[model samples]
Target chain A: MTEVVAREIIYCDICSFPPEYCEFGGTFKRCKDWLQANHLQLFEKLYSDDALAKATSTLSIEKEQQISRDLEKKQAKEEAKMERELQKKLASKIIIKRIERNRRKHVISISGLEVCNIDMKKLAKTFASKFATGASVTKNAEKKEEILVQGDVSDEAKEYIENLLQEKGLDEVKVEQIDDKKKKPKPTAP
Target chain B: MFKKFTKEDIHSRSNIKSSVQRGLKSKFLEQFPKLEPAIDNVIPKKSQVILIKCEDKISLYYVENEVVLFQHFDDLVPSLRTVHKYPDCFPKVQVDRGAIKFVMSGANVMCPGLTSAGAKLPEESLPKDSVVTIYAEGKENALAIGKLTMSTDDIKSINKGIGIELLHYLGDGLWKLVE
Candidate 1:
C-alpha cells in the first residue's frame, strides 16, 4: 500500500471583496481553496461548501448576457407581431359585396375610386366568381363607378356594401339609390 | 462605432415635437370653444416661423424660429396607422353612374349622411361633428390632415353615421369660392 500526502492550501485573511492582492509574499489563487482554509466559519454560515466558491453575490456576467438577449428578442417579437396585426386588419376592409335583383335580369356594379388606390384588375379578378351573379365594375376614365344592383337591394344588403366602402376609406359616398323604374341588365352571351 | 447626428436630424426632431405640441393644443382648443384667451395663446404668430415638412408635406407652422414639425402617419398609433397606410382602399366605391366624384359604400364606415349605425361601436366614438379651418393641402388632394370621427374601419361599416364628423379641407375646396 502507498501512503498519500495532501498539499498545504493557503487562505486569505481580508475584507468581503474578492481578494485580488496580498500583503504577504505568497499569492492566493482559486476562491474555493481560499474560502475553505481561511474563512471556513464564515463560509459555513453563508453558503453550502460545494456551492460557495462559484456563487457570486452580485450580478454575474452570464446573467447579464442572458438578460440583454431576452430584451432584444422581446422587442423584435413585439415589432413583428404589430406588423402582422396591421396587415390582417387592413386587408379585411378592402372588399365589399353589392347585390341587385331583377325579375328577369339583375345587374350589380362595383366601381374603382381614385382615392381607393387599389389594384382594380386584381380586385376584379378576386371577386369575378361572386360577380358572376350579374356583378361587374366599369372603370370610368374621369369618374368613380359602383356596383349597381339591377334589382331592388335589400336594406341589410345595402348596409353591408356601405360598411365595406367605409372601412376602405371612401368617405362622402352614397349607396342604395333605387332606380324606381327597373331596367334589365345588359345580356351577356354564355 | 459612433455615428454623428446630422443637422437635419436635430431639426426634424425639434419640428416633430413642436408640431405634436401644436396639434395637441389645437385639439384642446376645439374641445374648449368658449375659452377665447386660451385659444389665442395656442395660436402661434404667423411670421415667426419656418416651413416644416409634415407627413412629407410642407407647412409653415413655426418657421422663423426654425421649430417646424412634420406629422407623419407613424406619429399616430395603431388606429391611425391602419387608415393612413391605405386611405383609398376602404369606405369608398366608384360611381357607376356618370359625373360624380365618388360614391361611398356604407359598409365599413358611414360618412356625411348621419343616420343609424351598423358597427359594434356606439355614436360617441364619432369625433364631435364640427367645421374646421383648412390650412394646407398635400399631393392629389390627399386631405393633408383633418379631425375625423371613428377609426377608418368604423366609418366604413356604419350604415347611418357621419364618417368624417369634422373635416377641414386642407386646400382649395374647404370654403365656397366667391364667384
Candidate 2:
C-alpha cells in the first residue's frame, strides 16, 4: 500500500493560526512581528505590499479601509486587555495559613492562591502524592477555594510555594505563612 | 458550542476499551470514507485513547494529550487540529475573505458569506445538517468546523442569515485546551 502525503501548515506562534489568517486574530501586529522573526520568506509572501493588495483587491477600496479601521480598534482594545491581565497576575498574593484543629494537630490551608495561574485540584493531587497525606481543595468560610493538606508540614509547604512562585516568574508574590490557634483554656497541671 | 469553555467544563476522563475504539474508528470511516487511508497513522492500533466528557454532553477523544475528535450527541466531528493534518480527507467549504474575521470570532456563517464573490461551494451541494470543515478565502489552514443549516443550493438562492452553525474556531477554549 502507498502512503498518502499530508499537508504541513505553518501556524503563527503568537496567535496559533496559520500565518495567512493571523490578520483576523486581533493580535495581528504581534503575530506579524512573530512571523517575520521566525519565517522570513513566508512573512514576506503573506504581508508584502503586493500580496496585501491582491488579497483585498476584490473589495471596494472604501469597504476595505472601513474593515481595517474596525480591526485596528479591536487590536488596540485586545492589547490593552492583555496588559491589564498581566498586571493583575503580577500583583496577586498567596497565603499559606496553618489553622489549628487542636493543640497537637494543624491543618495547612493555602488561600489567596485563586489568582495564581495553576490549577488548584491538580496541585492538591501533587501535594497529596508529594507529602503522603490527604490533600484536597475545599471552599472556606468566605467561599474561596483553598487547598487543605492534613498535616503540620507548614514550613515544607511554604518552601514549596516559594519555589513554585519563583518558577512562575512571580517572585514578588508574597507567600505569607500565618499560624492560627483557637481560644482554649490551658489544662491546669492535670 | 464551546463559546466560553474552560477546564471547569470537563466532568471526567477515562480510557476506553479497544472494542469501543474500533467502533469509533469504523463510525468515523463511515462518516468520511476518504479518511480510510490515513486512519491508522492518525490513530494507531495500540495507542490508548481517553474520552473526556465535558459539559452539555460533549465528549472529546484525546490521543497523546491532543483532542483529535469530539462527539456532540451522535455526530463524530474532527477537531481543527485534525483538519490541519489531513485536510483532503473531509468535505470542505470556503468562506470569502471578508468573513474570516467574523468566523475567527466564532460567529455563525451567513448565506451571503457562502455565496459571495470569493467563496466557492461544491458543484453537487451537500445536504443540511452535514458537518463540513471551513476554510477562508486566502488561508491554507481550515479555521473552523460547521454544520450546514441548509443545502448549498438553498444558500445561493436565499443569500440571507446563518448558513452554517459554527461548532469550534481558531482561538476558542477547545483550541486552547492543551494539558
Candidate 3:
C-alpha cells in the first residue's frame, strides 16, 4: 500500500481561492465562476481559516453599514432631481410682467355677473374673446355668477382688469390672483 | 359580549336597549342641565338612542326620528372650518374676536367659520351640507347644527343668503358627536 499524505492549503486574495491555484488576485475577483470555485479566497485574505468559519457573521455588519450610506446618498440625489424638475414645470406655467400701457381695455367681472346684467349675448362674446372659456349664472333667483378663463392670467391682465374697474369708479374691487395650479380649464372633447 | 337581536327576539331580548337608553338620558342630563326639558320635548317617543364614547368625549343622539342626521352626514359640514358667511341659511351666529357662536331654542353652537364656500367641487358643483359642532362661546353655549351649503368660503365672499342650513341643536356640554 502507498503512503497517503495531506498538505496545507492557500487561497486567493480578492475572491477567496486557494493560493496555490491562484497566482493573481484580479483574474479570480473578476471571474464569476472563480469565486464560486474558490469561495474562501477573499475570506482567507482578510482572515485565517478559523476566522473564515465566522466569515459571513462580522462581514455583513460592515456591508450593511456601507449599503445604508450608499442608499441614502442615492435617495438624496433623486429627490434633488425631482425638485428641480418640479420647479422647471411650475416656471413654464406662468407668464407675468407689468401691464402694457396701451392694450385695448374691456370691462369684465371675474365672477361674470356684471357682464350678464348689461348684455347676456354680448357678455358671452366678450368673454369668449378675452377668456376663451365659459361662464355660468345660477338659475335660482340668487343668480350667483362664475367665470372660466383660458390659459394662465398674467399680472398684467389682472392689473388691466383692475384699472378698468377703477376707471369705471367701482368700489372695493377685490381681485384674487389665482394660482395656476388651482385654476382649472375646461376640457376640450376632441 | 355581542348578542343577536333578530326581529323575533326584539321584545324578549335583554334590557340592553333600555339600559343604553337610560344611560344616554342620564348622561345628557348631566351635560346640559338646562336643556333637559328641550331635549325631552325634541326627542321623538320611538327614537332610538345610543351613547357613543370616544377619547375624552361622549355623545348622545336620537336616531330614528331625527332626519337631521342624514342631512348632517350629507353636508360634510364636519369638514368645514367656519360658519360666519351664511347668516340667513345658518342660524344668526355671533362672532367674538375669532370664534363664532349661534343659539337655537336656548342651545349654543360654535364654529371657527374660517373657510369660504364656492368653487369647491370640480364641475356641476352644488352646495354640500355642513357638520357644525357647538362649543362654549364666552359664557354662551353653541348649538352646533349642520349648515346647508357647499362651502363657507362662498357664503363669506359672495355676500349671499342662507349660507348654512340648521340641522340639529347639539348641546354644549357632555355630548360631542363623532362620525
Candidate 4:
C-alpha cells in the first residue's frame, strides 16, 4: 500500500474514454477503429470475436437486440448532429473589421468566429501579447462575441485568425476584412 | 453537477497557498481513507493548486489544469478523471450493462440498475448521500460518480426509484472541459 502507484489508463482518442468503456460512447465505431489501429493487441483483447461474445450481458437476446438497435439510432442521430455542426462551420466566415475610433486612431473588431471553436479570451490574450497592444473580448452591437483589438491590426488579425482556423483543419473557412468609418459633422455656413 | 459546465461558466480562479493545499489534501484523505497511500502522489507537495469558482456555486480545485475535485455544496467530490486514476480509493457501486447508455447520457442511477444481476451494491451498505464511484459491467474504469439518494440496503430492498444522483460521467461537459 505504501507504493502509491497510480493506474495509467489509456483513453480513446475519438471519444476520450478508456478503451473498455467506448461501447457506451456515441462515437464507438470511430473509437474502436482508432483503438484497433493504434493498440491492436488491446483492441483484440477487448473487441475480438470471442471477447465480444463473452462481453455480452446476461440479458435475453431480444433485449440485447433492442438495446443495440437503440444504440444504433442514437449513433445515427449523433452523426447527423455532427454533420449539421460541420456544415454550419463551413458555411460561416470570420469577419475582421477596422473601425475608425478617431481621425488618427483605429481599432479592429473580429467577429463571426462561432465556427472556429477557439477560446475568445485566450485568443485575445495571445493577440494582446503578440501585437503588444490592448486586446479584449466584448459583445458587439449584434450581440455576438467579438475580439476587440486596440489599434489598427485588421490585416494582421485576419492572418492570425486564418492561421488559427488552419490549425483546426478549417482552412476553407473565410476570414473577411472590412472597414467602418464614423460620419463626421460639417461646419454650417451662416 | 457538471453536466453543462464549460470554461465560460468559470467566474474566478486563484492559486491556493501551500498550507491550504496541505489542508485540502488532508481533508480529501479524511473523507476517503483508502486514498492514504496515493494522496501525496496525486496532489504532489510542490504542485500548485488553483481554486476555480464557477457559476451556480460550483467550486473546482485544479491541480495543474486537471480538475482533481470540485464542490457544489459541503462535500468535495472527486472528478471522474481522478476517480479513474485511483478507483479503489472510493466506495463503489456498479450499474448493469442495460443502464450504461443511460448513465453515459447523464441519467440518474435507478434502483434496478444497481439491484440487477450484473450490478452490485457494496457489502457494507453505504449511507444516504455518500459519494460512490460507478463502474459498469465488464468495464475496467469507473464510468461515473454519484451520491446515493437512498442507502445501499434500501436500494436493494426497495428495488425502484432513483438510487444514486449522478454528478459527473464520462464524455459529459466537465469531462470535455479539462481534456
List A-chain TM-scores for all predictions: 0.29, 0.87, 0.27, 0.90
CAPRI classification of candidate 3: incorrect
Tell me the tens digit of each residue's lDDT in model 4 across A56-146.
7577788788888999888888878888988888988888888999988999988998787777889899999999999999998988899
- Angstrom error at residue A107, model 1: 0.8
What TM-score does candidate 1 get on C-alpha atoms? 0.19
Number of the candidate with higher DockQ, 2 or 4:
4
Judging by TM-score against the true structure, name the best candidate. Answer: 4
Interface RMSD of 1: 38.7
TM-score of each: 0.19, 0.94, 0.19, 0.95
lDDT score, candidate 4, position A77: 86
lDDT of 1: 0.34
DockQ of each: 0.01, 0.63, 0.01, 0.74
The local distance difference test score of model 2 is 0.88
Give the lowest summed-lDDT range of ten residues in model 3 chain B: B1-10
i-RMSD per candidate, Å: 38.7, 1.8, 42.2, 1.4
Structural similarity of chain A in candidate 3, as TM-score: 0.27
RMSD of 4: 1.8
Q: Model 3 has how many clashing residue pairs? A: 37
Model 4 TM: 0.95
Which ten contiguous residues of candidate 1 chain A have the minimum total lDDT? A20-29
Off by over 4 Å in 4: A186-190
What does candidate 3 score on TM?
0.19
